[model samples]
Target: MFKSRKNGVNRFAAATATHRQRIQVEHNSVLDSEYPFRLNFYNKPPAMDITIEEFELFALDRLQVLKVVEMAKIRNRSDEDYKKDIQHALDTYLPMKS
Candidate 1:
């Protein structure tokens, strides 16, 4: 289970302060244009170039997996049933993974 709102707020404030320090370092050390492109504040690398077809395929694969996970959680399915359902989903959506 997650923490209460008060704890969440305190954690958020601490994280934001830490982020501001890193931003200040970046701003002082490099020109605006010189800073490397990143996807998020944690400095995650940007995703490699992907074609529309590839993107669609990846989305479909993820959706299939997520749907199975949701069904298992929502229905409170037995472990064996969940495993079989997820395996079937994987076989249908991501045959290459095997």
Candidate 2:
């Protein structure tokens, strides 16, 4: 009975190891593909090298735009008002796209 119990533990360990390896592979694949959108959610960082200054600039720009959107939400503005505010914020911060 002792020997059978040990064998069972060993089998369970081996199964757990295999499961972990499968999960690692799946995780890597998901990270590689991520979402279809080009926008960065920081789940998978930008692949290309960027200067520190550029990174900071990008971070701050996005932050300010998001802050504006958050403020609008907190104010409990109407949908149209929120949209207008967000559009203005995006236009000011991210003018090229619009």
Candidate 3:
């Protein structure tokens, strides 16, 4: 059986409790009782933007390359060879936009 030590101090538990209280206060402040729309930090952005479809495509390309890198690592490849393979994958999947 695990028992809490009287002499030992739990700093993590105290910090977690403080964080949870702060999050609750922030969530309560943002809650909109009347309107469906709630204003938050994400609403504001620069004029330059990419559409969701394009973003998804970019994410998919990166994910594919990551899978390859992970597989290379799993195979116990050398660090230099892993780096080269990762760089090659990135170059092939994510070409510079011109």
Can you write out model 2's per-residue Cα lDDT over 1-98, one digit (the tens) per residue? 35345445577788878778432323344545766444658766578998999989888989999999999999999999999999998888777762
Candidate 3 displacement at residue 34 in angstroms: 24
TM-score of each: 0.46, 0.51, 0.50
RMSD each, Å: 9.3, 10.3, 8.1
* Clashing residue pairs in candidate 2 (N, C-alpha, C atoms within 3 angstroms): none
Clashing pairs in 3: none
**What TM-score would you give candidate 3 relative to the actual structure?**
0.50
Off by over 4 Å in 2: 1-15, 18-50
As for lDDT, the candidate ahead, 2 or 3, is 2
lDDT of 1 by residue, 3-75 (tens): 5575445777888887784323444322333344443353443568889999998898989889888988799
- What tens digits encode model 3's per-residue C-alpha lDDT throughout 9-94? 68898788778843343555335444325664554445688999999999999998989899999999898999998888988898
